[model samples]
Target: MLVLPAVVAALSIIFAVLTVGINFNLIHSIFIRKSLNKSKSLTLFYLRFVIDGFLGLQNAIMSTFILLKFLEVEYDEPVEFLFWISWTSMNCFNVRGILVIVISLDRTLAVFMPISYHNFRRRIRNFYLAIIPLSWPIVNNIVLWGVCQFRVNIPPGCVIFTCQMNQCYISYALSFEVVSHAIIALTSLILAVKLFIWNHCTQKGPKSRDLERANYLALIDTLIIIIFDIVPAGFTVKFPALSAQFGSLILVCKMSGYALESWLVRRALKRTNDIVSVSYANNSSMIKSTGQASSNHRHHRHINNHAWQ
Candidate 1:
């Protein structure tokens, strides 16, 4: 029964590791290229990459523990510490869910107010604000963990093996998941609608091309999130049995979102490189033309002087 989840989790871990390497390269590419170094939006992408990496690592570890305990491969006695570790990891999804919200909100803001967005992007301090949402999942899960540990008195052996929780805790967990799903869906819908309207509007004179590209990327991200995270979460809440089945698949979806972000970054970098190449070519041609014109003028002046002499 658990074999699929185990294999999926193992694969998720490998994919996550590869994602981390890819994200590192993406960030490095931005810094190494002088043109990309000035881009504040690209700098902000580092947050998403790090959060995605953390989520992947956390999910992988959580799945490993679940597999080990289920097969009785080791840890016959469930250590209190290990149980808490698993519990903490389980909450990472929620944190990632909130981070998705943060990304959506920031992208939306950039679209709505490109001028102000540029001003905001200039400050390093403002970029740190995205990290604030991390607390939401962290605090929520800690309280839930407390409820299980103190209020419910979960048996030590069943801590890992059982999904049986007090109705209150289960209700809270499901409600939280539902709420997060709703938020992600609603925000994505809003952005998609706005983008559609903007596309139709004849006058888009004020909007910067970069903002347009960013919003388009956000729209794609929202679609991906809806497919992977939101839908799976909704299904899990409605059908508890599927949670066990789709456990590692959810982790894969999370990693997929990160994969998308890395792809967007690389695409943006390529576009920038193309623009720089074209600009450099234009400048080289202009300089050569200017030099030829100056030489022609000097030659003409010499000819006139020699004729007069």
Candidate 2:
């Protein structure tokens, strides 16, 4: 028991640090470096990375606390703090689920309705659309907290074991998680199949290939979320005892998934930047060569006129 918690805590911290670092770079690249286009999809991705960073931090702290408790370290687990963390983590989780759906929809639109997608993004430069996902969890958690107060069998500490105390909230959250993930998975699968057929049936240009790549990336991202985040949530709802035994490990897996996603996005951004830079360089060279050729042509015409005169 002690060994498991200790190892999990270490892994959690390592992945948490990695996640934060990679996500920071991803945010900087997207917002600062301007490696990707300013579209709704990238906006949602930015929000996702921000939430991922927070989740990673929360997991690290919670894992450390769990390890300390297991090691018999003399420390107090404040109920208020634990409850706050639990509540905030739940809210972040909900936001992430919404984000996954939005991301999938964004990709699907880009593939199926390219012109409309481009025009809509051009018109909506602000992040007003993001408020939907951001505000959903706030409303949900308020209702949950209000209902939990009426429950007679409240847990002593609002930590890992608190799910049993707030059965209603747990059930609602788990169901939402599972259902949302299922929808996202189905959407991604259909989108992937459609994109595959489209690509196979037609001769595609660079723009088409880029869209294809984006769709595939979205598909991979959804897969990671389903495997690590959704599966764990479903299993926790079905086997609550499993959560108590392997909560730290589950957190580790979640962090690992986020870390992997951050890395993939970072690499994609770098590749895009490289391609853009090379294209710009080539265009500049072509323009310079054209200018020189025009100048030589003009000089030759001037000499010919003087000789004829």
Candidate 3:
């Protein structure tokens, strides 16, 4: 079971990076070309691409730090870069997690209450784009300030910080981190589920089915990320000795879940397409210009997004 988790994590990390790398290219193209008729869906997706890449890079940093220890070659006095990357990613992921839940809720709303969704329509997703990156600095300051104040010391090449055992209460940085992440994850999960059930009651049959699937997938993704990442990350920060091994296992689980999430999203969206296509076909409304629907750019986006992030 243990080895399986490690292997799954390594594979997931590779798969996640490969998928996100391709998506990074696509969003960059879309962002650069800047001509595609932008919809809220496209905007939210591109925004998520940015957030995922940021968090993915942070995962890389953390994985590298741990791997350095496993190889027994860490010869540094203080692994300071990790202190920042770890917490920054923590904050980034939580904030982004909230945003993902919000977007999924929006999609659910659009399906169930297309009329009512207009009220929640956002003019500037730009505000979110700016706010998420800005959150990293907040995480950074909090971590740095705590370290300076607490003076967590380890004399012999600290793989993880070794603070005074009974002084765990003094080390409140991690306590703060854990509480913040837990709150965000719990809140997002509750809202996502509530809106999804509301959707079940309100949507047309087929649209409801597709949204239900997406809603379910969204909740699953959120739960996995929380259980596998946030909870372990929290414990590891607070009690390194007790949590390190378990934390490593959790990291791997998180990476694998991320890879799986990509597939889930593609399938959910394809289901959405299926429901849309069936609705059109049943109406016998033959398109005058199938050409635009099958245009090269659209085809390219569809093909490329198969490795969706």
Candidate 4:
């Protein structure tokens, strides 16, 4: 009993912090400093990053409340808000995953239809605009949950062997979660394979080497994320429904995944810096050589002209 509440509380905190660090602390405040930035800035990234940022903030706020409840930090839950937040958080997360799925789809399209992808690339703003309406159904469900305060009656007060963590409800949520995850995993896997084949068969240039490295990085990232998120989230509340100490194992896993993603992103960015530096060095040397050649040519021309005169 003590452990379950604490575990829930801790996950609430972890995810809440993830929401803040990823969105407000980094993307919104530090990154989104441009007025009309579109798809270029890490903030925009074809509008994908910014949208994730927005969703992150919402997730963070919702997570904070859940953590607060677990702490028994009473804010007078009308039962309605609990229902709203519970469903909203889950749904919004799903929507966020969809955004990532779209990014995967975009990458696939880039590979399969390079010319057509470029044509639509400029209108990423439209892509973001389109995702907004798609979230309404999720939002509506949350609102309805709140309005109804539909709390599951599980031995009243505190949950025991009795649980609001009901099987049927869990099944419904898992069915949806697994299906979405499966779709994402399937699509990304196929794309990765196809990408590998193309990379193998195609040119072996410098750009291609960087691409191959990025592919390996991306593959690692996809697998890590898929493992963490393939939820029967009730699983969080059910199986290892162990104490926070026990959940520590899973917590470490989550942190490792986050760290890995961070490392991969930095590695990806580092390659860009290295390329830029090398390009600059090459350009500098070229300019210097050209200047020396010009000076020598001019000097020779003057001497020859003097001699001729």
Best by lDDT: 2
Worst 10 residues of 4 by lDDT: 35-44
lDDT of each: 0.64, 0.73, 0.56, 0.52
For candidate 3, the TM-score is: 0.58
What tens digits encode model 3's per-residue C-alpha lDDT throughout 63-102?
6555555555547734555655655665665566556656
| True-structure RMSD, every candidate | 4.3, 3.1, 12.0, 5.8
Cα error of candidate 4 at position 126, Å: 5.3
- State TM-scores per candidate: 0.74, 0.86, 0.58, 0.65
Clash pairs detected, candidate 4: 39-46
Ranking by TM-score: 2, 1, 4, 3
**lDDT rank, highest first?**
2, 1, 3, 4
Candidate 4 lands at a TM-score of 0.65
Q: What TM-score should be assigned to candidate 1?
A: 0.74
Predicted candidate 1: what Cα RMSD to the true structure? 4.3
Off by over 4 Å in 3: 1-19, 22-38, 73-78, 81-84, 97-117, 123-133, 139-143, 146-156, 159-217, 230-247, 270-309
Q: Which stretches of candidate 4 lie over 4 Å from their true place?
A: 1-8, 11-15, 22-48, 51-88, 115-173, 205-221, 231-263
Per-residue lDDT for 1-309 in model 4, tens only? 345655654664565456345534334433465322122323223243344345445444544554555556756544444444445545555564565565555556666776787588756764474465356456445543454344555342332211334454455555665676676687779878888777688836555434344345445546766866553243555666443334333333443444445445545555655676688899999999999999999999999999999
Q: Highest TM-score: give the candidate number.
A: 2
lDDT of 2 by residue, 200-293 (tens): 8864665543565567678878889888887876676688776656546567788888888888877775776677779889999999999999
